[model samples]
Target: MKLKFGFEEFILVFSISMFFFGYMRIKFTFMVIKVTDYYLYSYGNKGLLYCSLGLIALFTYFIIKYISKNVNTTR
Candidate 1:
């Protein structure tokens, strides 16, 4: 059976997907930095990157959970 969704739900889903995409990209970047050799340790950049990833991860979790709970998909 086909299903329909409200505009608000669509926007929320879009936002959650975007956040997840960002988180994945950042994770990849960090992995590359850690694996690459011969480069000097960038402490400041590493610290900020870790902090930002944590913050974004937390936000993404909350956003998806809240959006899913709030959007009634039972049609």
Candidate 2:
């Protein structure tokens, strides 16, 4: 027997992975902030926080765009 993998499966896996990745990033940012006393006190911590936020925004945009495109194509 052979198993088939397609775009939908890829998107499902990608979305789940990104979710966990984003969650861990945010958690790590909080941990850093706590250790550093605040986000403003260090450039490295601030950069890490911003980078994670940017990644989250990008992920959201891509996921929405993909879903919208698929929805339009299906109709």
Candidate 3:
């Protein structure tokens, strides 16, 4: 099947992919840090890790999307 899509479609897909990969990588790194910290603490608390990673991911995604939008806006 051959479906034609404009350049905007490609940019949108690329942006979404970047955001997803960024979030997953950040979340995975955060989990690893939590596990190591837990080992050292023995009685660890991981309450804010999720929130912290989520915020980071969100901010990063927004920044990336904004840049992509602006850089390609002229197109």
Candidate 4:
């Protein structure tokens, strides 16, 4: 039998990437909160951090919504 890969698999992979980025963002946020001086010195401004996190989150949300819509249509 042949294996099939489609939208679900695509979403799964993309979701994993999103999760990894999200985790990194959270770790940086915690560092910023716990060690403001060092974190700021190392990472510069927080605006880029927040912006990247928001974009990743928004992309992931849209992917999830797309997956749900595809599933509903297939059924």
For model 2, what is the C-alpha lDDT against the true structure? 0.62
Lowest lDDT sum, 10 consecutive residues, model 2, at: 36-45
Give Cα distance to truth, residue 42, candidate 1, Å.
Answer: 16
lDDT of 4: 0.64
Of the pair 1 and 2, which is ahead by TM-score?
Answer: 2
Q: Write the per-residue lDDT of candidate 2 for residues 3-75, one digit (tens) a residue.
A: 7887655655665665556566666655664464454345445555555655665677678778989999999
Give one digit per residue, the lDDT tens place, for model 1 in 1-75. Answer: 667787655655665665566556556566675554534235435545555665565666678767888786753
**Among these predicted structures, which one has the highest TM-score?**
2
Off by over 4 Å in 4: 1-44
lDDT of each: 0.59, 0.62, 0.56, 0.64
Candidate numbers, best lDDT first, in rank order: 4, 2, 1, 3
| Local accuracy of candidate 4 as per-residue lDDT tens digits, 2-74 | 7788775666566566556655666676566656676654553354554465567668768788898999999
Better of 2 and 3 by TM-score: 2
TM-score of each predicted structure versus truth: 0.41, 0.44, 0.40, 0.42
- Residue 25 of model 2: what lDDT? 61
Regions of candidate 3 where Cα sits further than 4 Å from its true position: 1-3, 34-75
For candidate 3, write residues 1-75 as lDDT tens digits. 778887645655665555555555555555665466645343222323444544565566677778999999888
Stretches of candidate 1 exceeding 4 Å from the true structure: 1-3, 34-75
- Return the top candidate by lDDT: 4
